[model samples]
Target chain A: MTKMTIPLGPQHPALKEPVNFSLVLEGEQITGSTVNLGYNHRGIEKAAESRTYLQDIYLLERVCGICSHSHTTCYLTCVEEIAKAEVPERAKAIRTIVAELERIHSHLLWLGIAGYEMGFETLFMYSWRDREQVLDCLELVSGNRVHYAMNTIGGVRRDITPEQKTEILRRVSILEERTKYYIKLGTEEATVLARTQNVGLLPHDVAMNLGTIGPTGRASGIKCDVRKHEPYLLYGKLDFKEITHDTNDVFGRLVVRVLELVESYKIIRQVLNYLPDGPIAVKVPAKIGPGEATNRYEAPRGEDIHYVKANGTDKPERVKVRAPTMANYVAVPYMLNSGYLADAPMTIAAIDPCMSCTDRAMVYDTKKNKVRIYGWDDLRKLGIEHYKKRGVDFSKL
Target chain B: MSEFEKEEKLKAQLEDKFGGAISDMIIQRKDRVWFEIKAEQLVELMNFMKTGMGFNRVSTITGVDEGEKLGAFYHLTDENGIVTVRAKTPRTDPHLPTITGVFPGAEPYERELADMFGIKIDGLKPGRRYPLPDDFPTDQYPLRKDWKVGDAYPEEKTSPATEAK
Candidate 1:
């Protein structure tokens, strides 16, 4: 039998971002695989070195369009530690609310994407429709949906008002009701079961060995949630359960995320109920005293870690971010390899990969004795030419 | 029995194992701990931390280029607590032994360190350029203090992480 390679993405319709995987397939069962990431490397860390900490916060938020709040919260928390600035009680509570809202929206988005992978377009549409409610609540509180510049240096930028609080809960209640229906479909639906159950299995050992984070690790019964582990932000004060499952497969991941949505609802409600009266932010000094700090946040995907070192200057000496996607990709081969070819999309989407947060690619131009950088336009042109060479009229495209 | 005591137990275990190799033990926060050591002792220390203390998860492997010295910080954690080991390597010919053999999970981070700080992870496997364009200038390390947006070689105005957004 001849072993053939099936390459998926640096650009694929199924993948949300730019990631390339070469799966060596022998009669539809992947015998071996290799991943080529960095197609979306924006040089965030290197760029962070240039920007002031204030501007870097916004830049970091752009790292992942889905979980922007997670990046900002983690970044602010680390810088706050170094500055020794105390975020007011009210600010902490607001941060938790926004963070949980982002979690809900992000999870729903993942659910929708996973649904698409399973060819369940209805589930995809319904999950995304519910996701909008969470985003609406987020907008009500933070004034923006995706890159909510809700977090600042010392604390949060805006406080949730009483009217906004009531409205948020009103929307969240409806979102929760919709989530229950989705969870039922996720578990009991026949097609979903066939596609997801007993697929992309990651035993406890494999998860730990690969250092899978967030719900992926929890699905394998690892108990590695940073929210519980470190107790950053209001996570220490908030009352919630760390959702986990023992299924150890794609089904397990779905269960963990769907159930976590319920927990996020409870957490957001608690943060609002116990909302304290205080300033949202304190005056952080222009120059932070020389210090180093590490902050971790439980982003919707998993643990997002940021390391910051200040040289008593406006700009940080160095900033390193290890997004959960980086830790989770090692499991891709384990999940995708040796499976029926049809399961590849669900297995890959199960990790909820954010390639924008994970990649950096540089092309070597040996012929020109220089490197050639290809931007989006260049790639588009190449795609059009390939289709034209395939005897298609791209002018119509 | 107590939280700090449990952290102390892990620290004492590491201190017993590494001793003078870790120049100083600095407890940054409640759950966060830092250990400063030389670059040569890093891989062995990382292996010891995993095998000896059962600290299996590495939060991240960070490469920092201080104006004078280049550094690698290994933030390791598990169910017990978090431990960060900071080791400094020389600026010229910057190199640190890869801990992938120990942690296996440290490979991506080590690769990023190689690409960004230009810190050679002695035994890192060959892979695609990380978090940077492959055609990115070879010699100019991006994160170094001296390596500004257009400092070393002004081949083109843009940078690796510019699209890194």
Candidate 2:
């Protein structure tokens, strides 16, 4: 029997990022996998060198959309470390609230995508419909649903108004009830369990070896959450458990994410009750001082690390960002090549891959690789050849 | 332990490791340590801390493009607060001894630093490009100071999430 490799994508409808996975299959089961990235390397760190510390906040927020708040919070934490600036109590509370709310929205969004991948269109629509509640609550406080621009130098850019707080709590209560139902349906439904439960079993040692982080790492028994470990902001003060599972399977990942929604709600409630009173932000001084710092925070997915060096100037000398998804991608091949081709889309979707936000193709006029064909013609030819080999209609191709 | 006491203990441990490598170890405002070390003795100093001291957790490995040369930062930590070991290698051929064999977490960090800064690490697999695309042009490092960022680079402008949203 001859074996063939199937290229999943540099472009696939199921994937949000341009991660090309060459699935070497023996029949319908995946035998081996090679992962490809850099379809979304936006030179974000390098761009920070040219921008001011204040400007980098808005810029870095654009690095990953789903985790934009996390990115901004992570960057600000590192800079705050270097500047020795203290974020006021109210700022910390507000930041923590936003962080938790973002976590809730992001996990729901992932659950929705996973549902969509498994052909559960109703679940997908339901999750998104519920996600809008959090979005509306976020917009009510931070002005924008997506890029809230809620972070500043020494503190947060905005505060949660009293009226807004009531709305947030009311909406969160609704979400909590809805989330409980979704988790019950997702985990207990026989079809959903059959599709996911034991499909992608990333064992503990292998997960650590691949350097998987966030919920993926937690799913595999690795207690490596920045919140639980090195608590920055109000995470240390909050009263919530580090929800972890040792299964390291697709179901384990799902459970961790769903439970995190509950934990996030609890943290949000704590922030509201213990609301602090103070200014939201303070003016940071600009200078060329010889100081640098590294800060890590728990993003919705996993650990987000930021390294900031300032020469006392308003601009950073160098800024380095390490996203959780970048670390978790290392374990993808390990997870995908363990039987079940049909479930590949959902298993990959579980990682929530976020690439460059504005990835544009730059076609240089000079290149060497036979006679290059452009655009749809190339795709059409490949499709025709594929269908012809499979004895399918060329017109369908 | 308090963050200040954590810094103090780390400072004493560093001074004991290399005797004179501790140029300045101050507890910064965040209660994190800012430890400065001489460039030449960094790799040996880090090895000593790993083998001798109890600084087992390797938080991150990063680089700063300092025009003519690059400054390497090995952010190491434990239950005590963070301690950053600062070192510099020439920009022309920035190379460091690989710490992956000792500290397993450092492998990905080293690879990322190598790909981004073009810094070579001795003893690791010579050609391991994990994240950079295969067709990505040679002689160009994406995270470097002078990588071409004109309209010609495909990933020069945006991220997928921005377009998706």
Candidate 3:
């Protein structure tokens, strides 16, 4: 039989971002593939040139809702490097706390997504329910659910109160226990194993050559992580193993993420112990001297790198962000070629795609006075009304 | 095994391989031997570092535009650390041979550099479109200094007919 090509998306239920996966299938097995992207382009780097250094903190934080802290941390680290600024011990500890909290939230969110992809609603519900605790803890510190604008150029914006500290530690211990239980279930559970084991296998050599990062890279036995090697924030000073799995399969990737959740919990507990007392932030000079710096951090997805060039101005001269999903997206065609049609959704979902993180945008509904909600009929009605108002021919837009 | 000795050894080894191609070897702060080389020598230098000096990992491929010139950086890190190889081409006639044949992993990166910087890859198949929109202008490059970001994306406005249609 001739191979038939199936197009998965620039918009599909299986993907969170706008990526088109063109798969050539021989019956149920994928034989070849091509991945396309460029939807939701926001020209974030160019827009960054127009904003001030302080303004860009909140701006960059919105890059990825899940990896929001990662973007801010990466951008702040680049700026700190350029300014030659040393974060205070207390500030560093607090930053570590927030970063760990972000990681916990991100991994849990990914877990829920993975569960949903596998058609395990029970697992999805439980995972999201557990994730709510971390979100609460984050809100206690950062005061936002999605985009926590806590990171600043020199340090952090919010300080954890003594009561908040106790609450955070208590919550961390609770999460640690729940995470341990879930990890046991994930590893030994029959269904998870059936779905994930030996699915989407990426051999070590292929992973290394592909330049994959994070758990995706780790799953394939490629010990490449920016946090472990480059050592950003308190990662160098902190003690935590660079989690890896030798299996190089879907199950292996799941195991790596599960193990990392526990490690993030351990890091958070350690950070709380070393918590110091000091101002949360410092006065950044209005005029920063011209300099360039590159900051790379291991985001929940993979290695997220940001290059910042400052020209002694409040606004940056230029900023380029390299999201990990973009790198991992390259390896998708290879992975799909090795998997069956039954494994397609799970394998595709394994690579967490966040187009908003690669770029940035914000929309306001001025006329509606609330967020705009588009439905098929509503859109059609709006289109009809527009033609009536314009009093022009219907063919041309 | 000492950091200084290792740095010196790598620097010397690199010098021996490509005479006078490496320059401004800084040993501190963002530690990496920064250098510029002819476009043709990049793939050869990358191969030497990967096979000879053990720089097996491609850390990142970044593109920069400097008015009449465009610079591309191939940052590779081994079990040891980072080795940065920077190469450039004239902005008007931006063309570079494909390195994907040697480092299969560099394909996405090369395509990205090509798409964003308007750098043409001589041997790359012409139809491989990754991130650019289907309707994006063929000649306009997003990362070039001259291609004003403001001009690249026109202000998004919903026309009445568009909404109606």
Best by DockQ: 1
Candidate 1 lDDT tens digits, A294-335? 878899999998988898988887888888998998878888
- Give model 2's TM-score versus the native structure: 0.82
Q: lDDT per residue, candidate 2, A1-397, as tens digits?
A: 4677998887888676777888988778888887766677766777787777877888999988878899999898878877778789899899899888889989998888878887888888999899989988888888777788899888888778889999999999999999899889877987778777887788997776555778888888878777877888888888998888987788888889999999899999999999988898887776434577778888988888788878876778788888887778767888888566787888887777653222123345555534453444466776788888999868652
Q: Give residue B51's lDDT in candidate 3 (0 to 100).
A: 76
Ranking by DockQ: 1, 3, 2
- Inter-residue clash pairs, candidate 3: A53-A314, A383-B163, A383-B164, A384-B164
Best candidate according to lDDT: 1
Q: Candidate 3, A348: how far from true, in Å?
A: 1.3
lDDT of 3 by residue, A334-395 (tens): 88995898788789778766532212233468987776555434766767788878885453
Off by over 4 Å in 1: A355-397, B1-3, B151-165
Q: For every model shown, what is its TM-score relative to the native structure?
A: 0.89, 0.82, 0.88
* CAPRI quality band, candidate 3: acceptable
Backbone clash tally (model 3): 4
Distance from true location, Cα of A237 in model 2, Å: 2.2
How far in Å is the alpha carbon of B24 misplaced in model 2?
5.8
